[model samples]
Target: MPRVLHTAQALVDVILEIDELPPRGGNANARSERWYAGGAVTTLIAAARTGAEAVHGGAHGTGPHGDLIREALARDGVILSDEIRPDVDTGYCTVLLEPSAERTFLTVYGAERQITAESLATLAPQPGDLVCISGYSLFEPTRDPLLEFLETLPEGVDVVLDPGDPFADFPRELQRRVLARTTVWTSNADEARALTDLDDLEDTPEAIRRRLAPGAAVVVRDGDRGCLVFHHGRGTQIPAFPQKAVDTNGAGDTHTGVMLAERALGADWESAATRANAAAGIAVTRHGTESAPTRAEVDEFLA
Candidate 1:
């Protein structure tokens, strides 16, 4: 089995359920809790749960939050060998969940922003490994390191780029560079629009895939509308299973992790996306990112 290497931000997420979002300076009654997972770590956990040998390449801190991150990853069977700064604290984010299951996030960069190119080079991923790069790590400090790492990837290695929300204004050069090396690119509808600058948000998956890397497989997720997958010059739109949505925090991460796991298990692109859509459909029906469904749940959902 190919090892899945994930290079991105890992943080401690503080989730809050609120009756209503505060209007600008206005305050509201918001119920909040904390979770010890974010971004790449969250995806790595999902991937490991699916029987993948997952390794996390990122930075954390020596603080309590950092310890929590390590414990959580260790429990999930994720190999963590990246550096952690003693002075800096682990990154954190605040998730505000509304009644409609819509969520808004305010994040703070901590030691995760300190992941350097030199540190990433130590991973030494060989050909056939799957490298997962999160878009949130494309900011100022981590951008150069990520670019350097991507450029040095060996041939035959499959690269999966999931640029999450922070990369809306990512530079064209970096975007092109990353996309050029990407074998699979996954993004939500808003992210697809931001990356492609498409006027019609509801364009076909084939059209969106064309706008992206010409030869790479693309998966554009349309929330409850389902996900459209384009690969091998073919397009398939998989409808999302209707379920009572609780929170959509890590649904995209679940989809990406499951797709990569399927690919590693020798499934074709279409079949992988089919399984991924099912996994994510089951994910959003629950609250919190870490509450993603198990492999049995996914299999049952597909059945």
Candidate 2:
């Protein structure tokens, strides 16, 4: 019986403008726009929607953005145990999209970077709880505290590490420290390559499982191609369901969150991975991170 806790950056994302981006340099014209809640908040939302008792622990500032984050989480049934710091501005990111649908992001970390060891300690995990730590929260000042908190967890609590792109930003030694204790690790192809230092990303999931924690499961997500799951000395690749992707922003988070929920509920690794892939496929067919589908939607997709 693993109670779930989610920790990471929580931010507002504004889709600045959609334009024709030249492969080389020059920009084009503004077309469409939208905004959404981002980071582990999105993942926590997904987890809660799937019937998991999820609590979000992260830093936000007292402002409109912070309100949006809190309101959005509440709407999804996630408990907010972490407080918003006084007067600080919540973080935001501006996304630039090209005609090819490729995206470039300009982010302001804002209050997310202000998370301290004390803040992490406040959300300490009890026995049989699972702590989901995000990669974006593991760089610089937050890194030490995040690691310290992970180390302090009571025995028997599971730790799931979703080292987003920030996995590359960490020093190898620091990354090793986190992975050593992680019961599960999730990332995409590029992230897998960077973290494992392997050029052949197709082999990364197996390599990472072998080298890091032989018993730990590894999930390597490949956009459009599908996702691969490595566990128990076996590998399974699940194909991505066909869908017209409107935005792929939170697909990975959705996949990871759903996978965790299914596993927590006693689903087998293959079944959980398949369910996760279907959930993420549904996520991409919609706009924004919070648009991730409900458990019913995933069941429908699976059916």
Best candidate (score: TM-score): 1
Report how far residue 296 has shifted in candidate 2, in Å: 0.8
Instruction: Give model 1's clash tally.
Output: 1
Q: What is the lDDT of residue 141 in candidate 1?
A: 88
The residue-by-residue lDDT of candidate 1 on 187-267, one tens digit each, is 888887876667665564555565454567888888777787878877778777767888878888988888888788788
In model 1, pairs of residues that clash are 135-163
State the RMSD for candidate 1: 1.9
- Provide the lDDT at 102 for model 1: 82
The segments of candidate 1 whose C-alpha lies over 4 angstroms from its true place after superposition are 166-168, 199-214
lDDT by residue (tens digit), candidate 2, 246-296: 677788999888888777777888888888888888987777879778899
What's the TM-score of each model vs. the native? 0.93, 0.92
Q: How far does residue 14 in candidate 2 sit from its true spot (Å)?
A: 0.7
Name the weakest run of 10 consecutive residues (lDDT summed) in model 2.
15-24
